[model samples]
Target: MRRGGGGGGRRLPKSSLAPSAASDRTPLLDPHVLHPRNLDLAFSRRDSDAASLCSSRPSSIGTGPSFAAPVTNFSDRASQAAALRVVNAYLAPAVSLRPPLPSAKDIVAAFRCPFKLTRSALKAPGTPHSWPPLLSVLYWLTLLVNSSESGAGGDDSPAASNDLMLYITNSYSLFISGDDDSVASLDEEYSSKARAHAQAAVEASQALEKEALDLESKRTKLTSGPSRLEALQAEKEALTADVEKFEAVVKSWTVKIQEKEESSVHLEKELEAKLMDQQRIAAENEELMKKVDAQVVNVRDVDRMQREIQSVERDNVKLENGNATLEEKGWELEAAVVGKLEEIEGLVEQCNQALRKLKPGIDFQYMLNTKASSPVELLGTSYKTIMKPALNSLADEARRISILKHDESVELEKQSQRNAKILSEKKNHISVCQTKTDEMVARLDSLDVEIGNHVSRCKADARLMKDELEKKDHHLSTVEKESEEFLKISEKKLEDAKRETDEEIQMCARELLKLIDSVTEYKEFMETSISGMRKDLYETVDDISSLASKAASTRQTSAQFVM
Candidate 1:
């Protein structure tokens, strides 16, 4: 095969000849050229030379022109040949000497030369050796050569062409047999692709059909107009009712939350006030303790004052006793002085009687002693003056002592009265201080009790508030969870509805496109034939347009709802 020597006559065992691909790339044949045309060019070219079909150069055989251009050029040749065949069949009874021409089927088969060549070429494996292309070129040349030679005037040329045709056909069969497995595999693969494509198309068509039926049913129901409209209105009313009920529930919960917040604020204020009052009571208690301490000092001072007063009373009693003893001693001294004065008076009387008795006797002797008596009289006068001065001084001394004792007694009574008054005043002061201290203690105790109660109440209130706050937080979290779940459910429902709506929209669009294609073809066919039918067709077009517009609007609304 590599030496290019396997061109026409090579053969091999069935297994060794299994076909393989030349390359992974797709073949260059345009499968769109289904039929042939331009019979004149083909026939003229065929008659121009016999040598063009049997060129010995392998390059000339392997690489001719591309198949696309030639196939297009000969597009209508098959129809012409068929027409000629028909004409020939009708004229066969009248004229019988005409040479046979290739039939329409043969002409079409000739046009397919390029495709068959490409397919065979692609099926070869490894190196893109020249055999398949050359074989294809030979296949084409053989057909042209046979077609041209069949109509030749010489009988020997016809037999030669027949032998050539037989040789070419056998060679083509051998080449095909060499690569049979590859061709078969390719055919199987293509068949599978075609089957899959057809299945998909059928499924799509079925889906469109179902959608069309659904749309038709929906249209019919909607066209009933009043009944469907009434049903929609009823649904709207039910939805509005549900919305109102939910709104009411939301409002009530909001109100309850607001009330709870207010209560919490009030409780906070009360607790603050209670704390402040407790602080104040504690301050007052501390002040009372300070005052009680001061009062205790004052009471101690009062006690010292009372003790001093008691000592003063004791001194006053001693002074009073000393004054009484002085009075007794004074009385005794007065009595003794009186007794001594009486004794002095009796001695003076005896001396005076003796002097009288002696005066009678001494009258005789007085004449003699007259001069001596004058001296005695002078001594007596001196003695009497001295005695009077002394007596006066003693009486003045006694009066002074009595005046001092009376002044001392009066001073002692005044001091005793003053001491009693001072003691009573101090006792009254002590009693007042004690009462005040007791009052302060009671007030402090009351304050303590009140402060304790406030503290306890504040603690309890704080606990209650904390519990309520926890409850509120729990309730709020539950509400949030419920709301989230509700939102999720609504979103899921919207998504599902949106998905179904998108499917419906796609289905409608496909159905509409198909309808438009059919309608266009029909309109083109009937455009000039029926003006009256055209009016109805225009009306149908308008209806289709309106339906498309409605479908578009419904899709937009559904999208918005999904959003």
Candidate 2:
């Protein structure tokens, strides 16, 4: 409990009691006299008297010499006795004693005192040179005792208190010595350290608050996960149903398309058949046209036939006129012949009359018949007979020629009639052929018209079919677009959902990492604090043990001196 002693000492008093005004006048103890060599010499000279003097003194002392009192003369026996009693009282609770006590050298060694001390310095009749060393030792022992007691009390550890006190004392000393820079530097250092610690604590608190908010958000997300998942599942199911419906519609459309294709194929086959029929009809019409062309007579052939008939008629008329002229000439010639015959007859009558008159008819006949009657007689005899017979023969020949001319005329008339009839028949035949040809041409025109109409009808049907197919194509395209849009929407929704889930996962992973880092930092801080505390405890224990040993040795020394 006492606290007045050396500068390094903890709670040791410089003396047992307050100093009197007379004691204050004495000079303070010399630091050099407390040297180890002086202590050894003084203890050697009074070794015998120290034990008796220490026994005769009382254990309790009310007051003692002040720190300023000189110990060079070694004359203050009461101060010595008071110093011994204080050492005994301070050590009694710390050490156990036996009958034979140990020496002061042993006590000094056990205390691990920084100063050199000897047993002779603690004994009675101690030398003045040993006094300061003795007081120094007592002061060290008192500090040790107080430190030990404080450690045991558990109020505050002596080592920590002592370090704080030392720092405060150093700061005050620096300030008193006018070392303002050093003091300010130290203050700044401490202030900076405090600021650093406060900043670190603020940052840590902010980090904790941020972490707590993150955890809360994460918990909220976790809590809502099932509901969100359910919603997504429902949406997916709906999309699946829509897809199924779309697929069904597509299937139906495909079936309809197949039917349409089959119908179109059938219609194409029918159209082909109609086209083939039309081609056959066209070929037949062409053949008929060819036959008609072959049968049709040219106008030049009819004109030539008509001209030939006119030429034949003209030849017949000419032949008839020639016959008539021939007939007239024959008539004239016959008349003249008749006239000559009459004249001849008359003349013959006359001649007969004359012959009769001149010579007799028998005689004339006989003379003509007579042989050689001369050229003149023969000529005369045959003149009338020859002339008569020639006349008769000419008549007969003329009549026969007339009859032949008549027959020739009749034959020529019949031939002309036959030719006229043949010409008329040819004309009629040509007209019939023309009429038939006209009919065929008309029929060909009708067939051509019908074929054109059929072709137009077929073209109309094809146009209608094309329009229908285009309409169907437009409808199908619309349906396909709708399906594609639906699918795209579903895909987009799925992608968005996936993105959200990924973000959540990443956020959770980051939060977990942050928690792990905070835990690691806290663990390291605790480990460092614990290790420092353990080291401090070990140091305190060592100091206590050393002080305990010193107290024990001092107790042994007091007991020896008391004996």
Candidate 3:
């Protein structure tokens, strides 16, 4: 496929390109542009994309900034035409007809135009063969050319001088002029801001005036009310008195409540301590019962061992007698079998020699007749003919031996199987025992956790009780102090009241005496009742401990039996 190209433009693959950045010391007025060789080449690329995109393609495309007043006018137009042509080609598939890029007339006309631009104060030719910096400037300028709006770019750029920023405009723009420092413009902005602030202040003053007038009117109404400062003060004083009276009553009530709570806490602590004691006793009883059960288990184990030993002794005696009798019989049988075996060996040798001589090629009877030896004659006789009978006997003996060996092997296998079965049973028993131990350990751990939690709770309760006791002590001290103060304050009044209310006081004294006598009697009765209750509780605790001990003993005994 053929691809379109833009005039005075170049194409570069990003991957094939290397960037050359300028050093900090390089001046802005450097006269370097894109690589010289890259500038002579037409904008063409292969191996990758070939689209007619309006992208920047820098290649030594620059002229002196001073020459921009003449060249930028027309050169930029030519560049624009080329760019437009490329853009048209890109959109040709969608829009069939398009005008050629800015015609020659437009390029010529643009050269005669004028544009406001910024110029750097630094002189060009600031460095020699500063290609590195020149390339860097071109890189920055290339970016500017590519991104500029309306394509307002050429070899010239906006001057760095402060005077350039202001009065800067495009061909038909009224941008801010450049003359003063940035601070001057900032000052102007601040001045306008100050004016706006003044206007805002004026408006705010008007609003504040209305608010002040409204506030003055509200003040007038507030002054007109009948509730004076002194009256408010008096009301506040009355409320304060009520608050003090309520506070005093609350204090007294709280004091009484605290005293009652203190006593209850002490009583609760006593009850908890008693319960703990009972539980501890029960636990100890259980432990003792477990020990007793262990003793029983040990006794049972001893009896089992003794019985096993008796059985083993009996088996040992039986095996010993059987071994001696079997040995004597085996010796006698061996002697008889040995002599018979020698005779059978001689006969076998004789038969083998005769069989070799009795080949089909040779007549055995003739060979025998020619030999005429003792062995040969014997071979041809009845004794030699008995070889078949002897061989049958040997076969039978071997069969008997094999049968006996097979029987013994079978018996040995059975015995091994039985022993293995017994061992498996023992292993199963051991595993069962281990499993029980693990379960017991789990139970013990659970019990320990429960006990730990209970202990922690008991400690917290004890601390709370101690706090209550301290609070009670503090209240008691406060009461004692207040009573002392009251006695001091009312000593004279008390004497005078005693004199004036003597007759009523005597009646009150008599009533108090009777009340005291009744209280003393009640105290004695409560003491006796409390003592009886303590004794009953002790008995109950003991009985419960005994029951727990019995239960523990039963459990232990049962466990031993299971083992």
Candidate 4:
């Protein structure tokens, strides 16, 4: 016989009851066997078995309807009561069979079952309709008992119990509907399933062993992790030190750069000032050139001086011609006076002769005229009247012409002296201007050389600064890359450590749960064994007391007979 609802079916040793006969007749009220006809047939057979078995024993069965009655016969009230009594007797070991035993509804409620079962349905007519739920309740009770007996702690979970119930129900249905051939097939199927289960168990054990080996290897690796972590920490400290040193160097370089910038700014300002000075000098030189241009003698002034000298010379020539003409006229007038004097002398001589003649005649004839004068008196009168006045006018005209020539000569001498003094001053000014121009040219050349040198130096400084900046940029980039790589490695190690710790915690929790379950089971077993022993000790005491009381009563009866 197989223990229904056990973890696995194990065949018990056959007794003298005959397996063939048991297999030929189905058991009564097997909850998994749902067919009505089969159930009735099985009940009839059970009734016959019970009758045969109880022929020599005292009858303690209830006065319900015979088991040979069909399920349809349970419709009447008396039959319903009888079926209820039968169900109660069958389930007496699992539930109380005393009066006021729990009703179907109370049982379902106690088990927290979704299936509805009422007291009325169990005790009223038409019990066939209530059989399925009742059978389900019986199946559930069977699973609970089997789980408790088997000591499999977690198998009583609702999902596992439900699955086992379905499988058993299906199998029992097939078993009831089939013949001997089907029975043999079911045996074969069970044997095959057993073999398959054994194979799966072996595979599971192998997988567990492999997992254990992997876990052991992982544990060994974890044990070595601290040393690597220490090394990484040391490397990180070294990197930090290097970073600090680099930062310090950068700070120093930045200070130097600031100083260089200040110097460069100063140089630029100096250059601007120099440029302004150069511009101012150039403007002053332009003004000087303009002054020189303004002071230079013009061609028109020289031409005008030459024209005045020509006019003065022409006036001198005219004065000389006028003096010659005056001289000639004076000569001609003296000649004419002489000739006229000759003619006048002739006429005067004639007149004198006539006078003389007349005077002579008069003198000769002193007696002829008393009013006759001398010849000397007549000549004196002629000279005083004409020659004296002509000579005096000519002398005054020559003196006036000499005075005009003397004045013109003095003015010409003064003009020539002034022109020479002016020419000397202009020559001195031109020399000074040429000397200043030479000095300015020399200064410009020096300034250009200085500017070129300064520009070259600035360019060299700029190139140096550029090279340094490029080197600094390269160093910074390399530092950043190294830091990033270190950070990534550190992060990976942290994640791995966290995952390992989480797995260890979960494994410990599972092991603790298993230990708790085993301890609970052992404690329960001890309690049950203790309770059984206590009951046996009580029963032994009761038996001994009863035997002592019997012995005492027998002694008293024997003594009474003796009297």
Candidate 5:
């Protein structure tokens, strides 16, 4: 009997279960079996297909859905990057990281081999060691083992194949029926494309992650700029103190300049008065010179007149001695006139000394700089314009005095009058002092106007400083308002960033939980694999023990025959 169970890639040891060892075994199976229907019925329950081996487990939703980066419970943009990496892993064989060409059973499950031919080969208890279509006979038997004898090979052709292997998959059994070349060519194409896709995806994801980090850094710097403005404001304050100090120094210098300006104006006024006094003195000197000249001439005339009068008196004496009393009267009158002339000559010398003392020397450029209203104007034309009239008036008075002196002398011939000329000169001196007082009053009025102009200039400067201070204060206020606005805007942006970070963190956390569940799934898969391994080992052990019994019987037969 060709007996097989779920064994394709699970080959039995023929050395252990040979027909020689089965001499006492049942002779139900034989070579050249014609009953394909019987074989199909026999192996129907034991068809080893790739689909029948692996079973899938149901999964449920596991841990966190929301997760994020450190700054927020927000998903790092890394989540997207990780997603891309995972996708790449799926697409690439080089990065697949699955086990190496899996053991035969695993390959069977993965490829879903479509054929099971082991049941088609027939075998009997005492059949020859070399059987035709051996694998097919075994596979057919394996398929028909669980069938009823009538249903075993009733209509099934699967039990009639010659050479094929079987697969056990979760949904169905499969049998692979391809040559080595085809399988290898398919594998190569699949692996190559998968690796290519994986590499490209991983590269793109890495690039994107780096870009995200760069953007985050740029945002941080942009946010810091507003605070830097505050630092700049502090610097401005320090500079403002320096500016204030400069302003104070400038103000002090301005005050000094103002005082200097005032002093300069006062000095200029004083210089004008001194120039006027010099001009007045020069006029007086010129008038005095003319008066002295006139007095000298008068004295000379008086001397000549006295000499002629004496001559006349001599002639009169000669005649009057003949008429004696008339000549005596004329001689007495001439003596008084000569005495007045001597006194006038002494006064003229004194006036000459006074004229020298009162003389004004020329002052050049300053005099030219002055306007035509200056006494310098008259001096440049002629001293006569400034002084000749006064000298004439003085001369008139002097001549009048002289005439009166002559009259007085005539009287003094009889009365000897001397105090009359002195009294008249004193009266003229008082009148000249009154004219000087009037000139002084006009100079005081001009000085008062200049002082008023200076006061107005000072008031204007003070107003300008006050306006500047007001403008500075207004600018400071505007800057403060703008700074406040900037701070508000920056704070709002930070709040928004904080909110975004928090959301991303939540998303990332969820994704992290999903990854953890994936790990758990992997562990479950490993555990399931271990359980399947234990089951397979148990099956293998049971198969081994059955073959050992058959082998022991064959050995006993051989021993008995040899003896």
Candidate 6:
């Protein structure tokens, strides 16, 4: 039985499996086999002579089912993990069933029979011994037995065990078939093939012999005798003359090629110089652009400074107006204080006049009391009552007036001091403001100077740039002129080279025409020679045919005798 038979027999129902994926479709495998029937029947191993078989051999093993799964897990990591799971599942049982290493005695015992048989077979060589195939069968049987005994069962154990049994049975069948039958069959097949190959080889050899004989006969006929020595001598002389003419033409061509090469070198040098000039011009242009950009930036700065100066001037004007208003307020405060002082002085004079009037009334009352006794007594009482009251009131009025004057004077002095202090503070503030204004003016003037300097510098730089540009322009113009002159020279040289080449080509063409005429003459002579050779060849051919016919008759008779 074939090695694939067991694997091929494991095919489940068609309903459980799908067809293969189309070539263009993304390939996928079923995640789990969904057996429609779920047949739990244990498959018995096919009847054979061997004790056991293993199904690990690669054969017609079914790869479960094809699933039309979507391409969702496209990541390499997912694919790798899936592959690892598959490998682990497949290797698990194999690893579990792996046989332990044999001891030395067991190893010797295991190989002893086969080794002894091999030795005996090698010794008895003429017996047509065969050990390799038998040994392979034995090795497979041993593996089947060991794996079956040691294997730990899993989900796929039944299928694997069935296949293993089938492999063992197949190996047993091979052994039962026997070496004698296999050797006999091989010998018969080899013998038949050898016979056919021998027949073919014999026919090939006979044909090769006939061809060799025919060639020998033709060679003999073709060598009739040497002739036409004088004609060949004449042809050789003509060929030598053509060779000399060709050499002369070749020499002239070499000279012309050298001149053209020299002119090309000169032109190449001129082109390189022109390229360098162009590169330099490009560099100068870039420099000019950089300078222009810098100038634009400087101009922007100058404009910004001018705007700042204008704003500063406006601020100075506002500060000046504020200072003027403050000074006016100070003058008004001083005038109000002076008017209050003058009013205080007028109050002092009015107090003094009231005092003078009170003093006369008191003296008049004392004089009336002294003049009348009983009248004086009564008068004294009246005077004391009335005048005393009037005198006391007058004195109190006088004292209150003096105190008011003193308080007014003290307040006026305090007001004057306060005004003085205020004026001094105002003066100090004005001075500070003036200083700030002066500083601002100075700063404005400095800014103006700076702007003027910047303008002057910009102008100078512009002038410098103009001068540089003019220089570059002059240099470029000179380079252009030089390039033009060089180009003209190159053109002139190219024309000269072309003319020289044309003359050389014409010379070569004339020489070639002469050579062609010579070759035609030589060809005509050779044609005449060939015609004579043809006549001779025809006679030789006739002789060779007669000789070949005689040889064939002799060969046929010999072949018949041999038969």
Among these predictions, the greatest lDDT belongs to 2
Global lDDT scores for all candidate models: 0.54, 0.61, 0.53, 0.56, 0.50, 0.54
Q: 1-563 in candidate 2: lDDT tens per residue?
A: 11221112222113422234322332222221222222223232232333342343222233331122112212345445555665677767777768687777787777676455544555542446566556656655775665455444444332322323444766897899899999998788767876897899999999999998999999899887778779899999999999999999999999999999999999999999999999999999999888867885886788899999999999999999999999999999989967965665666567667756644224332222223335565336565664456557767888999999999999999999999999999999999999999999999899779867766666666667667556655645554554465455545544443444345345434644564566577679889999999999999999999999999999999999999
Q: Please rank every candidate by lDDT, starting with the best.
A: 2, 4, 1, 6, 3, 5
> Please, what are the lDDT tens digits per residue for candidate 1 over residues 1-563?
11122222222213432223312212222112211111112222111122332232122223433333212122133433333443344445664545688753365466655432223233542222323333334434443443344334223321222223333444565467797665566556656866897899999999999998999899898887678679899999999999999999999999999999999999999999999999999999999988888763577788999999999999999999999999999999989967965665566667556556633223211111223336464224543554456556767887999999999999999999999999999999999999999999999899779867766666666667667556655645554554465455555544443444345345434644564566576677777668768888999999999999999999999999999
**Candidate 2 worst ten-residue window by lDDT:** 1-10
Q: Summarize candidate 5's per-residue lDDT along 98-160 as a digit string, tens digits.
A: 655654344433433322223223323122221222323333233233223324333444322
Q: Model 3 lDDT vs. the true structure?
A: 0.53
- Candidate 2 lands at a TM-score of 0.16
Which residue window of length 10 is worst by lDDT in model 6? 34-43
lDDT of 3 by residue, 177-220 (tens): 44346546655665686689789999999999999899989989
Per-prediction TM-score? 0.17, 0.16, 0.16, 0.17, 0.16, 0.14
Model 6 regions more than 4 Å off = 1-479, 482-509, 525-540, 556-563
lDDT of 1 at 202: 100
Superposed by TM-score, candidate 3 places the C-alpha of residue 466 at a distance from the truth, in angstroms, of 78
Q: Report the lDDT of model 2 for residue 117.
A: 54
Q: Write the per-residue lDDT of candidate 4 for residues 114-221, one digit (tens) a residue.
A: 234445336642344445445544544544454344444333342232323334544676678776576667667767877898899999999999998999899799
RMSD of each: 55.3, 61.7, 57.6, 54.7, 51.7, 49.7
lDDT measured at residue 486 in model 3 versus the true structure, 0 to 100: 46
TM-score of 3: 0.16
Could you tell me how far off, in angstroms, the CA of residue 447 lies in candidate 4 after the best superposition? Answer: 99
Model 1 vs. true fold: TM: 0.17
Flag regions of model 4 displaced more than 4 Å.
1-165, 178-211, 226-240, 255-263, 270-563
Instruction: Please give the lDDT score at residue 40 for candidate 5.
Output: 24
Instruction: Give me candidate 4's TM-score against the actual structure.
Output: 0.17
